[model samples]
Target: MSVQLVANVLIGIALVVFLGYRQATWRYLDPTRIWRTPLIMAIVGVVVLAQTTTTITTTDVVFLGIEALITVGVGLTMGSITRFRTVATPDSKGRTIQSRTGLLGAALWIVLIAVRVGLDVVGGHLGAHLLTSTGTILLVLALNRAARAVVIDQRIPRDDREARGMMVR
Candidate 1:
């Protein structure tokens, strides 16, 4: 395998491990802060896309579209299964809502990774190489996280949303 591809695989695995842990642990669900990760991932993905020399083809487009759909679907599923409850913040007497994916959420992440890998195998055979690029992977991850954030935000009470400095949709 090429060095770049190897590096991408390592980075992708690291991200999965880190993000999976974060999602599986109970953390304060601040609507305002939850979107940051997705936004940052998207920006980085765009930057990587700009720097890459890969030629995009129709096959790449089709595969990426399908992958994006699957990513978002899995993310939404994770959000729906997430456990949320009010809890006292470590440093504060007041209670704020916290969320965790626990086991099921983590399992969904594994499913997403499996799906992405399966798609990569098919796309590679079909010469849809962009599916294997770092940019594409990051973009797919951002879409998944964004979809999950949307579902989580929706579950938050309007009062809690506004109190946490998030505009209610």
Candidate 2:
């Protein structure tokens, strides 16, 4: 078997494990606080992108950069939507609007990929993908933390009131 095949298999296994872990944790453990969904998706995207690598070119780098920018804009929009929904209509129906945090997370992953491609295009002066991935991972971690802080600080009281059957009016 080729090294690429081996890497692909490993990545697949890792994704499976991550999914299992997420499902189990959400179902039986702590559903409210588990924030691994974004990180997991990011890892899966990176793995898929890495596995499909042909000869890298400037065009590829530019395309990746454009895609990354678009994804980030989408993610920011999603985050705003989530914040709006969570704030403006808290208890209308929990199942109505989809959460946008996942989109933001996916965008972060794309940003990492774009950074990697950029580094490669710049003659690989750095560790390319590894560094880019690490930086984006850190950014994601910070974003998640900030988001949780905002939710905890702002949303909890509203949620509690709604749970107590108190109408906001």
Candidate that scores best on TM-score = 1
Summarize candidate 1's per-residue lDDT along 10-107 as a digit string, tens digits: 98899989988987798877676778888999999999988889899999999999999999999999878877777645326343777888878878
lDDT, each prediction: 0.83, 0.40
Q: Which residue pairs collide, candidate 2?
A: none
The TM-scores, one per candidate, come to: 0.91, 0.34
lDDT of 2 by residue, 19-121 (tens): 3343232121112333454555556556654654455556545544554455455444433433322334433444222233344444444454455345445
The lDDT leader among the candidates is 1
